[model samples]
Target: MILTAFLTAAVLVASGGTATAAAPGTVAASDREVQFVSDGVPAYGTLHVPAHRAGARVPAALLIPGSGPTNRDGDEPPTVTPGTLKLLANALDQDGVATLRFDKYGTGRTGLGGLDPAALDLPTFTRQAVAAEQTLAKQPEVDRDEVSIVGHSEGGLQAMLVARRVRVKSLVLLAPQDLRLLDLLKIQLDAQVTAADQTALSKVITDFRAGRELDYTGMSTQLATFLQQAIFSPVNTRFVRSDDAVYPPSVARPGPRVLLTCGTQDTQVPCWTTSPLAAALRTLPRPLPVDHFQHAPGTRVNDQVLDPSVVTALRTFLEHR
Candidate 1:
C-alpha cells in the first residue's frame, strides 16, 4: 500500500511543473566557491565562512538540497527570490557558523550522468549527500568533529542515512516527511490536485493504492508513464521499507543532536508529517535532544525571498550547538 502511494507521488513530481529559478552569482566577502569530485564527477558548492574565524576552526553545516533540480543556492527554474540554501548559508555565516551548500546530482552547474530521474533511488541520493559532507569535513576552516547536516525536504531522509553511516555532531531537518514514501506521496497528490481543481487525483490515488495503473482523464500519456516508473518502481519500495534506525540512540557513537522545523502554512510538507517522527525519536533509549520550530504564515508575504525568522532560527540552532 505504501509502495503504491510512493510511486504516485514520484510520478506527480516528474509531471509537475514546479520551476527552478536562475542561479545568482552574488556572495558575501566571507564566502567562496568550491568544487569537488563526487562519484568521479565534479560538483559545485559555496563555502560561507565567518569573518571572525580567521584562525579558529568554526562549526560547520552541510546544506543538503531538497528534491528536484534545485541548485546550490536553492534557486529553481520557475522563480528566484528565496534562494533557499544560499540564504541559509549567509545567515549562518553572519552568526559565526560556516556552511556549504551545493547543487544536487544533475542540477545547476553540476554534471548530469545521463541518469533518468524516474530511475533515481534513495541510495543514490544518499551517496551524493554523504559525498558532500565528506568533502566539507576536509576543509581547513571547518571543524570536522563539530560539523552537522541541515537537510530540507527529501534531503532530510538522505541526511539521516548519512549520519547513521558517518560520525557527525548533529542534524537539522526542515519539514521532513516521516511517513512511508508511498503514503506521503498519496497525501501530497491528493492535496495538490484537489487544490488545482483536478478531479483525476482521486481516481489516480484509488487505482494506485489497489496496485493498478492509474488511467485518469486530462493526464498526458507521457506523464502517465513517467509517474508509473517514478512511483511504483522497485527501487523506491526498498527505500521506504528499510530499517533506518541502525544508529539508535542506545548505540549512536559520537551521538549527534537533532532539530526539526516545519512551517504551519507549508502545504507541501505540513506539521503533521513531522510530529510522528519526533514522537518516534523520543521513544528511543538514548534519544538526542529534538527541537521543533513552527513558523506561522503571514497574509502579506515575500515569495521571492527567504523568511528572516527561519534563517534566524537556523542560525541560532547551528551556532549554539
Candidate 2:
C-alpha cells in the first residue's frame, strides 16, 4: 500500500491549546493533536496520552506510518476508512501505554507553515523520527527511557534508520521488506502485470536499476504513474533509489531488542516469502524476538488479514515486553 492514498486531518493542536479530541472507536478523552518542528518544518501528530494515565513516567512509543503520503492515522485521503494506526494507538492506550503518530512532510499540516513542499526529500521525512523522539520525550507523562518506535512497511525501515542514530528500548518492524525500494517495486509490479507484459516490465526494472529512464512505448498509463510514485518522487528519489537495502547493517542488532513481523497475505511487502530476511536477522549478534502468532489455521488463521493483528502485536510488545 506504499503507492499513495495518504490522507488525514491535521489532528493535534499544540499543548494547552484547544484539545480537539477525535471520537475514539474504543476510548474517550484527551487524545490531543500535537505539533512539533522537524528540521524547521512544523510537523503535526496526535499524542494518545491515556485519560487514565497515571504515574510520573508511563512507557510510550512513536508509531511511524507506512509508505507513501500516509497520514498520522494509518490511511490516506478521499476515503479514510477505519484507520489502522488510530486503532493501534487506541490499543496501546488501553494497555496504559502512551502513543504518538504524525503526518509526514508534504502531507497534512506539515508544510503549510511556509516551508516549500518541493524542498522536502527523504531525509526531510525520515529525520522527523528524531524530532518526534525529542518532542515526545519532553512530555511529563512519558517514560523517555522506555520509549520505542513501531514502524509499519516503509516506516519500519524508517525505524531502522532512526535506530541507527538513537537508542530505544525496543523496535518493531511490521511487514517490512529488506529489499531496496527499486527491487521491491519490481516484485510488486510483476505481481500486477499480465504474463505478456512481464518481459517489458522486467526491462523497466533493469533500466530503473541502472539509473536509466523508463522510456517505453505503449506501456499502460497506470504503470507509468506507478513509476512516478514508486520511483521518481522527490523523497523516493533521494533515499529509495538505491541498490543498497538498508536493513542488515544499518540496524545495530545487539543494541535494542527488535520485533519483526509479516502478514501472510501482505502482498505489498512479501518479506514473509521473498529474500527470507529472517535468516540474515538470525545470524545477528542479538536474536530477533521470536515471531509471535505463528499459527496457520483453526486459530482464526489468515491467508488474509488486516492491521488489527498488528495492534495486538504492538500492545504485546510495548505493554508486556
Best by TM-score: 2
What is candidate 1's CA lDDT for residue 245?
22
Q: Model 2 lDDT vs. the true structure? A: 0.61
In order of appearance, the predictions have TM-scores of 0.70, 0.76
lDDT of each residue in 1-321, candidate 2, tens digit only? 322211221222466522334444423335677877533446778887765423446777888887666778766674543365666677777777788888776557553456554444445455677678667777877888888887776777777777777668888776665666666666777888866456667777677668787765556777767766656666455445432345433453546777777656455666444334555455222222222222232333222223355656666666456
- Superposed on all Cα atoms, model 2 deviates from the true structure by an RMSD in Å of 6.5
Determine which window of 10 residues in candidate 1 has minimal summed lDDT: 4-13
Q: Per-prediction count of colliding residue pairs?
A: 13, 7
lDDT of 1: 0.58
lDDT per residue as tens, model 1, 204-266: 656655657657577655545655566545644343334232222222233477776666666
Residue pairs of candidate 2 with colliding backbone atoms: 5-76, 6-76, 7-76, 7-77, 12-33, 12-34, 13-33
